[model samples]
Target: MGEEQFKGVFVEEALEHLTLLENALMELEETPDNMELVDSAFRSMHTLKGSGAMFGFDVLSHFTHDIETVYDLVRSGSMKITQELIDLTFCAKDEILCMLRNDYDTIPEVQKKKDELTKEFKDLIERYRDGGNGATAKGTLKKPDGKSIPDEIIVKDIEAPRYTYRIRYRPCTSCFLRGTNPLLNIEELAGFGRASIVAHMDDIKFLDEYDPDACYAYWDIIVTTEKEIDAIKDVFAFEDESSEVKIEVIDVSGELDGGDQYKKLGEILLEKGDLTQDDLDSVLGLHKKLGELLVEKGVVNADIIEAALAEQVHIREEKKSQQTSVEETATIRVPADRLDTLVNLVGELVTVQAHLTQMAVKRIDYELLNVAEEVERLTCELRDNTMNIRMLPIGTTFDKFKRLVRDLSKELKKEIILATEGAQTELDKTVIEKLNDPLVHIIRNSIDHGVETPEQRKKVGKPPKGTITLSAIHSGSHVLIRVKDDGKGLDVEAIKNKAIERGLISANAELSDSEIFSFIFAPGFSTAKEVTSVSGRGVGMDVVKRGIESLRGSIGIESARGVGTTITVKLPLTLAIIDGLLVRAGAGSYVLPLTSVLECIAISKDEIDQNHGRELTMVRGQIIPYISLREHFFINSTEPVNQQIIICEVNARRVGVLVDQVIGEHQTVIKNLGGIYKNVETLSGATILGDGSVALILDVNRLVNLVEGVERDAVKRLGMASEMSVCE
Candidate 1:
């Protein structure tokens, strides 16, 4: 890979580490005594610092190192996790993201933020050094067992008592694929103090049989350092489970008997576990060296003997020293564009499968039909698998709102808690990405307009800390995301007055509370008496409506007088493909989503004439309102003698769509109609048919809404006419 590609990988990995850090910090705030959370945060920062420096992100590495130190203190129990430190770390995490995006240390504004955060972190470190603010004394460090040890033992370069450690490291065969370089780890181990390393090359294959991507050689490293055993363990902290590592303190502070002799070669080999005691004793009687004797007797491999010999010599030289040590999970990240391409290819395959099916049905060959059926089945499975790859749990987006709710509630001086449920409900990446903005607006509106202040809430017999529940539940092929708040519900009287004042609805117009509440989504409509930073400009709900509708989703609001308000957004599982009912109205073909289709019933022009201008029909003693696609789209054609009313459920209401024919089911691959039809709200997108014809996908909810809007205008005009006549 090129330098740029390597840096890109680093950026991606660093951002992920930052996310982990952010989540851990957020949780730490709730449970300050949770050492696991502190450890988790520390690990992420440590990785970021190490990887950032390796990837040439010097400024990011430096800034991270300081923060990592504070976390290290917490990990050591030398400092307690405080709200101030958590907030500082959160700010640092944000700044690190900025640094990563701006090439680390570039961009004057980001640099300034870095400087400020660096100062704060340094202050925390100083506080720890001075044993102030819940920090331990400067001269002591906490051990794993909570015992205070002198600080000199923890410092690597200090001239204090040290230990000599022998480390055995064997990398996994697939270690290279995971981007780990064992040599780098060995080099890091050498940095602690005087060191000697010997590679055991016995596992290497012949040149012709060699695999470049596989690590065949293992190592035995001997290090004499002032650092403690934990410091040595950290050198291999990131190694995966497939690799093997064992670290033991061979000699402490180079202490030896008056003879200045280390453990005998045979005993060292035995202690190193390279040979059993039987093998050591059998070789001990030989006149030649024990290592040479063992190799000749085939009792131990030449490489193992060589490593043991190396360890023996090194430890004898200084009377030397010591050294170290740690994926539970593995993942390969592919760029999103690649997954998008795969989804598009799968969609194309679905379309081709439909064409083959159509051709087989038209032909009389049974063999061809069977082949087409098999292909159809395979295509369906392939389509589902490809879509599944793009499916992400909605919890990722939910987690982001935690920080948002925290900041916004703090700014608004309202004590509110965000509660989420069904966060694991899965949705297409496309749908999830588009759903974010709308959900943000809804939650913001709820916090600003829906929820009352703590004082007001208490007076109303509600808890001071209000709760806004964000939840998702899968309903067949659709996902319903509801943002509900236990606050003062939307005021119908206020909405009614606003609608009339804005000329949105006529005074004294008979409307349901649902209809009245919907006026909040009108452009520039607000019930707030004044505007604030959080909301009240009225753009939030309007944006929410447009964003949801653009995703071919429907949103509805339900509220009680003093209880609460719930905004429900219903979205399709995926936008790439859908099961739709193909229908024809005049020359135009349309596809109604199969999930929305209830049933189709035959209706005639005679029945329509009985209802006259009402366009309402009696279906099993129930009044069913309908929209004629032919009249709505202005398709010029003679009315069919036999018509069908396709019953569809839209926004929890069943409505019928009049069409000339119901043409079975179609697997629809939706294609955008481009900018020309962008503003056309009634139609979502268009799809290609097996016969190579274009069929428009109907937005059932929007269609019903458009029809209701037209009917409402008619009623308003009629009411005015009746009033004028009475006056006359």
Candidate 2:
């Protein structure tokens, strides 16, 4: 309805188009011959160019046009999509983002960069066109079977009788410098067909202080022309370069006189009682401007005044609608903050509904209980809907690894093949956002450190190109993502010696193969002889560990020398809520993730045995290492004659935790500890129970590591113990 509102819509549509461009570029990297990806890329660029002009982004529109031309060739099958083309498109997409933000002056080098990229794109297309490729031989680009690809493919065909053209004319701010009357150009165009000039007053300054010579108004014209589209373009041929003009042809065949435009105008006139029904019918038949005809026939009051005012709003909205259609196809762009706010509101509704259900059950009121049950059902549905809104396919993140592998393999002079599977696995938007960097780090490590050189692979009787596989799948309530490289794996003995040499562990440290392999995740632990840019300063793996931990996730590694290494990360489906097993220790509540809990047991004082100051519990003939939560957190309480032990597993290692009481399962809403407690270990995060008490979530992996480390230290002291004694 207004220029400001129209501009807002345009901005949103531009963002949507940009996202499509990014996704298509990534897809094109894998399916270089996919005509659909090519066509979609071209369409996104074309729509951006059209919408940019409508919203007064002249430089952006002009710059995007060049890249669109290159894509147009690919879309028509005149040129093939290659890595070079996709890379150049990525550069162009970055430039478009700069233009959208009006950061042109700050990025003076942008034009040069764009020119260079476009030249590269043109050269690649030309190479394919002149290389005697099938595309070049046919004169016209042809499909694989030799059918000539058409210039434009209409996916949907519909019939329309009349076409409506929307014309937007925005003059340059410096138009007065050339002594040009923008209105004269508008008038010249109106002469070709029946046209209405709606002058946009949104940009008009106060009349008393306005510069009469300075053009402040833009015109939106709806011109019905039987002539071809070229005729409309020719009207402003002289001023086209200096002014912004957009023309959209809307086919309105099956309707009675076009749609909303006619209906709105009729309703406005009827409400004002400008003309009787008979008068309106005659004016409509005469094909004259309705407002002018009404005044001329003495049907009502002021004719020129109201018509111009009403026409301006109608024309602006029409232009906006046309631009919107060009930019956005099937999806709408929404701000991240808005989505976050919606999520928070949904969470609050769930919390409140839970409380209501609790109260309903306690009161034993049948009517209230029914209402509470319905509320619970609706709240669950609403929560799911919100979560779905934040779920994005993992394919997008996985696609980036292709480029990484290509570049790193070339630099290292090694042949590497990256294979991806189960890329359609979905994750929370926040998780995906944070996952990108960690995934890149892991893949880079695989290419630079894990994968062997071609010579070594050949010597090992393996293929020259080492294979690295990235896969993701839903495992229970968590997602399991694996990055496996088929090359020389970690040497456990070597890692143990390296750790001992670095003073990270004692020389006498006796550890299992898995424990030794995990030492790589320790800070400042690196076995590399020299540090390089790729990885192996021992920096990124630790960061990856911290990041996974921050998400309440776990990371583990499994490897065999001369075979391969598989690094697996387990993450929850949603971070907003979790099913937790609540327990009490030291007058406070703590939660252990239900997913990791194995089983709980109540052991009498006789059941617990102490050996060398370490506690152990015999559970079904298995000696499970046990830790007392009261002692760990410094709770000064006498050990109960009968204490409960909660056995949990982390990375397939079991440990028993002694607690005062088992609080059963809880629906946990995770709440972060304050800045002061951030460095505290053995706790991943804190959650609020239904009773408003906070329960700290146990970091099971860290607990297992600590307990296992103690066991290793104890074993080291009994170096000369017999085999049977070591096993005991």
- On TM-score, the candidate that comes out on top is 1
Tell me the lDDT of candidate 1.
0.85
User: TM-score for every candidate vs. truth?
Assistant: 0.73, 0.65
**Cand. 2 Cα-lDDT:** 0.75
Clashing pairs in 2: 161-253
Tens digits of per-residue lDDT for model 2, 500-521 = 8876677886888888987888
Candidate 2 has what TM-score?
A: 0.65
**Model 2, stretches more than 4 Å misplaced?**
1-37, 55-59, 73-87, 90-104, 107-112, 118-334, 357-378, 605-613, 637-639, 703-728
Clashing pairs in 1: 164-321, 164-322, 165-321, 165-322, 165-323, 223-322, 240-327
Question: Which residues of candidate 1, in runs, are more than 4 Å off?
Answer: 103-106, 132-330, 711-728
